[model samples]
Each structure stands twice: as structure tokens, then as C-alpha cells.
Target: MTSSSSDRPLLGRRSLLGLGLGLGLGASFALAACGDPGQAGTGGSAAGGTLKWGWALPTSWDPVFSSAGWDVHSLSLVYAGLTKLDEQGTAVPALASAWKFSTDGTSVTFTLRPGLTFSDGSPLDAAAVKKSLDRGRTEAKSLVAPQLTSVREVSAPDAQTVLLELSRPDYQIPNLLAGKTGMIVNPKAFESDAAGLATRPAGAGPFTLTSYTQNAKAVLRRNPAYWDASAIKLENFEVHPLPDAATVVAGLQSGQFDVAQIPGSQVAAAKAAGLEVQVIPSLVVAVLDVNVEKAPFDNPKVVEALKFAIDREALLKTQLFGYGEVNHQPFPKGYVGYDPASADLYRYDPAKARALLTEAGHPDGVDLTLTTTAAQGLPEQLQAQLKEVGIRATIDVVPAAQATQIVYIQHAKALFTDQFAGRDSAAQAFQVLFGEQGLMNPGRRTPPELAAAVEQVSRTPLDSPEYPKVLRAATALAVRTMPNTFLYSVPRLLARRKSVSPVPAFTAVQRFEGVTAS
Candidate 1:
């Protein structure tokens, strides 16, 4: 893999970096020309043109059922939530102009921006907000349902006000609402058959879906009556589904696309071709997950040995091409509650790994299978690394569905997977990957100290001084337990033409929301 120097600064700390990014978005937005891309007439020099966007296509057009990041991007162009996250994962206002939590922090009230109307010419009122959230929670196939763990009830008191009552004091609710689950769909669509709506959906975003071809392309035209017409510079927006990273990069260079997502390995290649690339150091981490309920993994010494065996620095430099940050704890460094010291628990040492394995009764060797979703050359690298430490790891390439089944359902001994926080909060990350109630915790067994620490962090106010201390304790416990071998937080890269400027905000899919095509 070729490595390149990025114009964007490398993220030294996760939380501080995130806050800085969010503040940048909140400061101001640039103006773009307004008009159709295909037309000649224009009012503003920076506005009135079409933006042709190309990225990995979404599997489903329905926001509730869509799981892939690309799908969220496509859906976000048409649908919007009450709150939207900035680049730092901070919640900024979107549909709802502002909100306030009760003194007890159990309920929140939202006030919608006035004069709002859906693309279909219906009022975007409090009732619509209630309906959208209820449907998202009730839908059987919705992958977003889990994010609403704290939502107990959603009620509309009047046309413009909506209230959400939570079961506990979850400060992360606003952040969660800024995510995919909070996307509001047309209530009329919900009244009809749910499956049919997947084919045709409606929302009140800056763009209207004029036409869609599943997993192929989606054509969008500007919503003439959009509440924020000034920001809707692009008269037309087109989304093409191109999943292959190399293919997407080639398309950008060939002028087939104005913007596209490319892997870190291709960042240098894209930059060398004179394309403008923006790198966002996000909370996405790739690691080898171990099922503690399984045989050898049930032993703590065996787990520690595996962590010390792999050369994480080499893996990041080679596999990720230096577009990532090495981390050994469940939460990436710099994130709120992450301990910098936890990363030093296990250093790369083949001899120490072999000694630990021998002490754990694997004198000869240990055989295990590492399941993954066909990551390029990663499985082979993992296998070779394990071999050096008296562990034989066979790679099994499978689709995501199959891999999920093997790791989550079938209780496979170990698997290589990537984990990310939907929200910026470390408490949420803990609940998903290490919490007893976490989906990844197949057996629901958790170390008591880790569980207590997570609980403390979740309940403590974000402004409280004790919050950081609680998170540090949680990070320490998580690293000591070695639930999984931490790897690196992969950097997200985007390559766009110099004429196109990316919006600073973050949508669910990180699409071209506020982008301007000059």
C-alpha cells in the first residue's frame, strides 16, 4: 500500500479533536452558486448548480431498515432528524431549532423551527416527529432500534412541540437523535404498507428524490420550497453506488464523479492525481474480537498472549498505510474516558506471547479460526502473525451476514471486525462492545469492575469533573480484561474535485449536504 502525507492534521486525541471539528462546523458555512448543473442560468455565483456525488451505494432506501453508512448518506439528503451531529459528533440543531432537558434529565422537550413543510407539501409538525420515532422503534427489521435504548415514550403536546421521556438520565440522547434513528419520514408513508414504502420514501430535506434505482443510482432535484433555500445551492444532486474503492477513485479522476469515498490505502494515489482529499480521523477501530465463552479464550492468560503477539504498529503502517492510529484499549485514545496508559499494557513480543501460551497449557500450539468479511490481505496477515507465536489461525472469508452469525450467534472462538461508536460518548461505545447489555457481549457476562465503571460514566453529567475519572477507570478495567485485541482507529478519507467544497457537518452517511459545486 502506498502512503502519502495528508493536508489535514493527524488526530492526537479523539475527544479534543472531535470538539474542534464540531466548532469549525458551528462557526460558519460557505456560500455556493445556485442553479441546475445542466442549466446556464444562475443567481449566485457560488450557487445554482448540480452536484454529482458518487460513493458506495446503499442497500436500502428506507432509513429505518438501512444499515450501511452509504445508505445513511443517501437517505440523509431527503430525510432529516430533529438534531444533527457536527463533524466532532456534537449535536447541533437541524429540524428542531433547540431543545431542553428536564432538571431530572429524564425528559426532553424540542421546539421545531417554524414554517417547516415536508417535500410532499405536508406540515412537518410535532405529530410527524412522534410518528417517525415510534415507527423506527416499532419496526421489526430496523437496525437503528438499539440506539434508542433510553427512549421510553415520545409524545406530541401540540403542533410544534415534541417531548421525549427516557428511562434514565442519558445525556447521549441528543447525540443519538442526531444519528440515523432520529430521521423523520413521511407519516403517510407509514400509514401505508411498510414494505412498499421502502421503494418510495419521502422527507423534507434540501433535496427531493426524483428517481431511484436500487443499489445503482438515485437522482435528486432541489426542493424548491426548502426552509433553508439559500443553503440548497445544488439544483440537482445525483448519487451512484460504487462500492469498490479503486473503482470510485478512478471514476473521480476520470471526471465520472465530483466526489467519492476512498480507502486510506488509496489516499496518496488520489492526492497524486491532483484530487482534493479530506481525511476525518473518526472513532472507527478494527480489532480481533474474541468470544470469551469459547474454550481457550475463556482463559485470561490466553487472551493476553494473543494481544501481545500481533505487531499493531506494523499492521497499521502496512495494512492501513499509516492512515490510522494504533490503540490497545476498546475505546480509542483521546476519546472522553479513554486512558492513555492502557495502550501500553501489551507490547509486541513473540517470545512473551509464546511463554504465556505455554503457561496456559498450549505448549505445542493452539489452533483457531479468524472469521472476517473479506478484508484485503488482513486475514492472511493475522494468520502469519499468529503462527510466529505458536498459534495457528486459519482465515475464513464470508459475507457480513455470515460473519455476524459466526461471531454473534454461533459463538465462534475469534473473528476480525471493525467497531465504531454511533455517538461520540465513550459510555455508548462501552455499552455496545463491552457492556453486559452490549450486542457484542454474546454471553452477557461482564467484568464487575468494568460494568460499574461504565454505569458511573453513563450516569454522571458530562460537565462534572468526576466524569473523566470514571471514564479513565472504565478504560483501565477494559484494557486489563482484554475483551479484544485493539488495533487502530481507521481514518476516513474523501476525494473530491477542487471545484467542489465539502460541508463541514456530519450526516449519518457523511454525504455532501452543504457542499457547493463551483
Candidate 2:
């Protein structure tokens, strides 16, 4: 939920290819034939200079109040949570050195690392943690409210100990704390109405915001008093917020920026131009939101048919330049609950798809509209794939804002091509995309079997021995019901000058924790 509207451009800009989408196929094919990706570029040592990052500006610097991806991305450079999520979505220590959940699962106790303080010279103690968490839980405008809905109370039992009591048994608390919900704030710097924290943000991160120019850029200087001062390699960290993909590419091309989030379609071009293209396997997935509550897709056989109609491997190769891996389940491989067996459920077989379609009473195939944002040649690629299985897919392209309104708000009954990135856990993703309250399940039409599986996955303790089984079962049920056809996980590509040694990031949000550029 921390992602903003401008964060939706996984595909390259329509203008970058110097042609409209009608010419997308030619451009993509021509670009795909340019060179071998593996041999495109290589790595080098950091040059030890000021690291300049060209990216979209954050919507707000206040972590609790901001849901924009760019906002969280920028705030991360200036904030630290109690826990941090690893590349595999595992919870590791940050502010909190240790934590333990009660046997009954109603309360979790945490022990803070000794002698932590915010950059504002205020103590980052248990009381500060409680105050920040309480505000996040109680604030009506907080974007993380849904993630903290199970919390009953937050208490600071002692100077270094914090107790979190929940209304129900919830195991994802640690993971939640590793994200925006657990990003602590300085009580002295923030006001009751949540005013003035953006320009003058305060945190215990390795860097301190020296200046912030709205819609333009933010400059961060090393926090001399930071607990992990040794990790601060760069003397100055500068971020330029530029939303347009073309503009970002131009910046990278013109040597104006040392790093930028380059689109997948531009990876080859960036590499050819001598930029090091680093691939970050994003948590974001491209999915066809099949309207299982309506006709055509309502039938399970029809859903199965639709799933088998597309070639995921080819799609990844042509659409993403083979930058990402193919995934059949909604959860990618690194995330918890992702089953390798699920990949076998839907293979690219037109004969099988047509057979299933015939069994579902559509002998001549079904006519459906696949609506999506202007995602380069994705719609056309999907349309051609679906046509091979005797299905007629009409493409409807809309702007990103209007597309969100149509799919999430209007509950449009079309095969909506959507890109989703969410909390690290598979259960959290299910809750957002397929649960009874999920965005795609507007009618709450989750099958009884899947509903029970989702419940089990939600209630099961993550560390319990039964966790993997329960998660796998939930994933299997989800695939069977087929509310959404899983496509490949999109690769978040970035271009950096060879002089920079970018720290490898598993997810899209780039962390410069140990990175440096000369």
C-alpha cells in the first residue's frame, strides 16, 4: 500500500520506442533481437562519490500517512523499522534486537536494542515505539490501518520492552513491523494532526535529510550519530524525483544520474549505451483478474481453459526480455507459501485449453475483453496468445488512474490485466487480492473450500510446523478456483553507472544500506 500512482510503470514508456502502441510489436521484437542479456553488462566497485538516484518523488515523507511506493522508497533512506524484511521476506532485527510471541498468540513482547535514538536527539525507547504504533493504529487517515486492524492495544511495560496485544491470533505481526506500520517517528517532531513531518522528517536511519524540495529532489547527509555509522559509505545521498520513465532514461543516458529505475523494455538500450542494467526481481506480479463471479469465467472449466491459453515463458522472454522468472502461483518463489507444484497446474497448451473451453460449453471459443493500462505490448501479446486457443480477446487500453477506478472501484466484469505488489507474506497477498474483502472479490464470491483455506492460512502461526502445509493448501485452493490467472513476476530493472556497486535487492524497493559509488 505504500506505492503511489506513478509507481505503476513496470513496462517502458510508450514514447521511449519512438512509436505508438500500434507499433509496439515491431519495437519489442526489434529490441529483443538487439543482444544477449547475460552478456549485456557486468559489475564494478563503488567509486566512493555522492550517490545520485533519479526516481519519482515521494507523495509524503510521513511513513504512516503515506502509501505511495515512491514515498516509502524515499522514506526508507531516512527511516528505520523495529524489524527489517530480508530478500526472502524473513524478519530480521533492526531497532528491536529480539522479540517473542506469547503461546496464546494474543501478545508479542519486544526488547529494543540498547541506546537507540532518533536523529532529533530524542530517545527511541519503548515509550516512543508505543506512541508511534498507537498513532498508526488509531489514525483514520493512516494507509496502514488495514494491516493493523487486529491490534487491540500497544503498551510500553518498561523502558526497553514493548508489549503488543492483539484482538485475535495473528502471526504476521513481525512481518508487519518490518514494514511501514513499524516505521517509528519522533514524538517531539510530529504533531497530533500529522502536520510538518514531511519537510522536517526525523528518524534514526544512517542518513539525515539535509534538504527537501517538493516534486523535485531530497538531499541526505550521513548521520554522524547513527548507531550503524560504519555502513554510511557515501558522504551525500541525493534523490531526484522524476516520474516520467522517458525522463528517467534521459537522465541516465545524459550522465545526469548515477542510478535510476529503468523500464524492462529499456534494459537492452541502457546496456547498449554503457549503463550497467541490474535486474531486481520485484514482488509485483502481472495477473489477469478473471471475474469468477460472472459468466464465462464463472465456470471452473472456463477458468482453467483461460489459464492454460497463454505461454508464460514466451511472455517473459518477449515482454520482459527474459529478465524475470515465470510463476504460476500468485506468490512468487521467494515468498512464503509459494509451491513449485502449483506451476504445473497451468502450462502453455492450446489443445488442453480448447478442450476445457469446449467442455465449458464454448465449443467455438469465448469472446472477452482484456482491459489494461498502456503496458507497452502486453495487451497485444496476451491477445495473440489467447487467440491461438480459439478465444477472442479484445484489448482495451486506459490510463493508469482510470484503470484502477474501473477494476478496484467499479468492479468491472472483464479480464482485467492488473499488476499487484503487496506485503511480503503470501497470506497478506491473498487477503488483498483474493480474500472475502479482497479487491478482486468485490462480490465476495470466494468458493467455500478456498474461503476455509484462506482462514486457516490467516490463523496459523507462521513459525508452527503446520504453517507450510496450511499455506500450500491455501495456494492450491486458490489456483483451483481461479479468480486470477497468474502470470510472470515482473522484473524491476535498474540502470547504474559502472562505477557504482549497487547492493543486491530481492524486491523492487532499492536499499542502499551497504552501497557506495565513487
Q: What lDDT does the true structure give each of the candidates?
A: 0.67, 0.69
What's every prediction's RMSD, in angstroms? 8.6, 10.3
| Candidate 2 wrongly placed segments (more than 4 Å) | 1-48, 68-71, 189-202, 213-215, 241-250, 294-296, 440-443, 458-461
Q: What TM-score number comes out for model 1?
A: 0.85
Q: What TM-score would each prediction reach against the true structure?
A: 0.85, 0.82
Worst 10 residues of 1 by lDDT: 15-24
lDDT of 1 by residue, 1-518 (tens): 00011111111111100100011111212222222322222223345666777764444557787644335566777777887656545566788887777777788888887867777777789998899999888778576677677789999999889999989877556656655668888887678766644556677776777776655667777765455555667778888765477577778877788887687778888888899888766666676667777767777778888988988888888887888778877555555556877767787999999999999999897987777777567778778888999989877776764555565556554555545433434566676667665556655678887777776765765555676677788778877874667777776677888888765534223645567786
lDDT of 2 by residue, 1-518 (tens): 11111111111000001001111121111101111222211111222468888876555567776644335567777788887665555666678877777877788888887877776556789999998888888876676666687789999998899999999777667777766667888787675445666455767776678776665667777665455556667767888865366566667767688898776778777788888887776676777777766677768888889888989999988877787778787666665567767866787989999999999999999988887777458888999989999899888877764554566556675677766665545555676667665665544576788877876765776666788878888887887774688788876678988878865674634577677787
Worst 10 residues of 2 by lDDT: 11-20
**Residue 233 deviation, candidate 1, in Å?**
2.6
lDDT of 2 at 465: 74
Top TM-score model: 1
